[model samples]
Target: MKILKLSYFVKLSIFLILPFLCFGQEKEQKEKPELDLGGALRFNYIYSSWKEEQKTKGGEFGYDMFRINAKASYKGIFLNAEYRLYSEAFGGGFLKQGWIGYKFNEKNQFHVGLVYVPFGIKQYNSHNWFFNITYYVGLEDDHDMGFKYLHEDEKWEYAFAFLKNAEELNFGGDTENNSSRYSYDVVGRNKETNQFNAKIVRKLGDSIQHRIGFSGQYGSLYNIDTNKNGNHYALALHYELNWNKWNLKTEIITVSHSPENKEGQSNKIIKMGAYGAPYEIAADFNMYTIGLSKKISVAWGPVSEIEVYNDFGYMQKKEKEFTDSFMNVTGLLLTAGQVYTYIDYAAGYNHSWLGGNFEDDFSTGNPDANWEARFNINIGYYF
Candidate 1:
């Protein structure tokens, strides 16, 4: 009789507290946040037609970069960041992008910190590894210290941002803006400031889709020497099409800058820098770009898919005395599990990163510049 009474008492105690225990577990699960961390390692092989020695040696292979990506979310708050490490000759190591955001609902959100400028096409404007000519001019994939508000629905998307300045390298009190960064910015005596951007996109169709977008930007150019602010503005119109396994992109952009520089300095040219170097770019220009791509699925071993693309870009300077710049890239992308590779044949005329000298290629380009070509292969492993 005593043993039966003891067993009954224990069973009654567990039954009385079981509901509270279940409730607490459910609440804890709901409060827990989600986190994801990932990274990539990449390498490159190059055979430049302009580099005689490299071409004679059958090209060169080297380490490209290593990068880390992190993301976290709790309730309606989220964080995202990426950091990259490159060779010392490049920009060394730097934070690519980082932002904290809050979602009010499914269609509205706010972001702060270093955010991408809402300009041009979304994400990348080109399918090739070299991107388009707009990237070198700081009009594509550019990021700044800013706050952004975004709204999206089934057929429309809109974004507005106000950027105080570009990302600063905080070394010391007299730290000068340098080219040790991932994106191009005004890095000499002048800095970008008080920039505002607005963008809207209209989406149409489902299986065969079309997207049309318009973007506008205006910013102040703060010259340290003059201590007076100048102004710059850009306008862009872009279109994208997706039909089955084929995609197409095209854009037209016009940009102009009026900077308050020191005496005797040319206002038609501005100093822009990135990847450990500075170069001059024309202050007023028009750019045009177009790209087409087709995707194919494959059953080859360790290779699941392939995409073939061709991208072309042209820049025309407002100053008639200055020459023009153009680039064309034919490439294919291969994806297999965690590995991705790009094989590209790129040709350019008066392009900065191709073969022309960096100082004036994008400013007063060389009229006698001949076409230069580079065959490159880049492979990356992602986790």
Candidate 2:
């Protein structure tokens, strides 16, 4: 019965889209050659292997996520939507991201609607259609819901943005009691984040460049005991200097936040969980990371890159004492809350349109969890 209902819905959606597809085709036939109306298709494939530890047993698991994206624009207004079909190996697939936007100026000005946050490296590609694995939107934490601004010229370029809780995923009912086990509430944390961000870039000669950026979010998290306030602020800096065949790149990030537990358990974590647990409380936390990367072209025409990084961090925890078992601390917590060290090393081949992103190894678990690696190859054409 469920499958029947789903099939009916899909048919209805296709029916609704038929008119727009036909209309677009008719417009193209009637318009001048200068009027542009077309869209591109993109494919993404991802695979991961995981190691699990449990008292009874331990084993390995893997999953794959694939996405197909389509986009179209007419004049300054545009629309983009994607369909994700997951294999049975990964449960199933569905639409991942879909939104629309408008271009504001000759320099790529834009006002996006339900669009992907336009504040990342993905916007610029040598192929004009492919993106690097690292080119992710900050708002990827959720669906981008808001506006964007961009400015580009010879010496200076910049981007600014705002996004809401547009792509939150909530599954099933009775979320308050069953969220952790079987449900994914779009606003699972029961919080709405209002984000404001900015990026500025400066060009210095042919071998040197610099970029600085900042992002902030303010919101509230709904917990059982009390409504907790939350906020996140981050600052970023990037610099690159090239000498002959070698290039030096440095990136830095400073982040601060105050978040709460949805189950209202901060107090227990502070008191009985661990001595330094207090620092891990749902209060306030701050961390900073700096990384230096070097890239050199090898005799094989492939570029090799290496990065060394570290994070220094601290936090202020929340306190609570309650008689209920549910309110009591139940797990091991480490306080004194200090990051002694963090680092990662990666060496890989470089190609156009696709590559990989290297991340520091903090190790909650899994070596690859601390980083991401991939091989990408794509093709694109413009008319």
**lDDT by residue (tens digit), candidate 2, 1-383:** 99999999999999999999999999877653332343333232222212123212432223223345566667667767665544443335444456666677777777555544433222321111112112211221233556777788777777777766444345323243211111111223334346676767775666554443333344333333345655555554554444443334333434344446555433222110100111111222222222222333334322132222221111112222211000000111111112111121122222111122211111011222222222222222211
- In the order shown, the candidates' Cα RMSDs to the true structure are 3.4, 17.6
TM-scores, all models, native as reference: 0.93, 0.48
Which regions of candidate 2 fall more than 4 Å away from where they truly are? Answer: 1-63, 87-91, 94-96, 114-143, 170-188, 212-229, 240-249, 260-264, 267-383
Error of 2 at 128 (Å): 20
lDDT of each: 0.92, 0.36
Clashes of 1: 0
Query: 1-383 in candidate 1: lDDT tens per residue?
Result: 99999999999999999999999999889979999999999999999989999988999999999999999999889999999999989889988889999999999999998998899898889998888888899987988889999999999999999998888776432345778888888878788889999999999999999999999999999888888899999999999999999999999999998999999999999889888888899999999999999999999999999999999999999999999999999999999999999999999999888997869999999999999999999999999
Native-structure RMSD, model 2:
17.6
What lDDT score is found at residue 165 in candidate 2? 41
Q: For candidate 2, which ten residues in a row score worst on lDDT?
A: 322-331
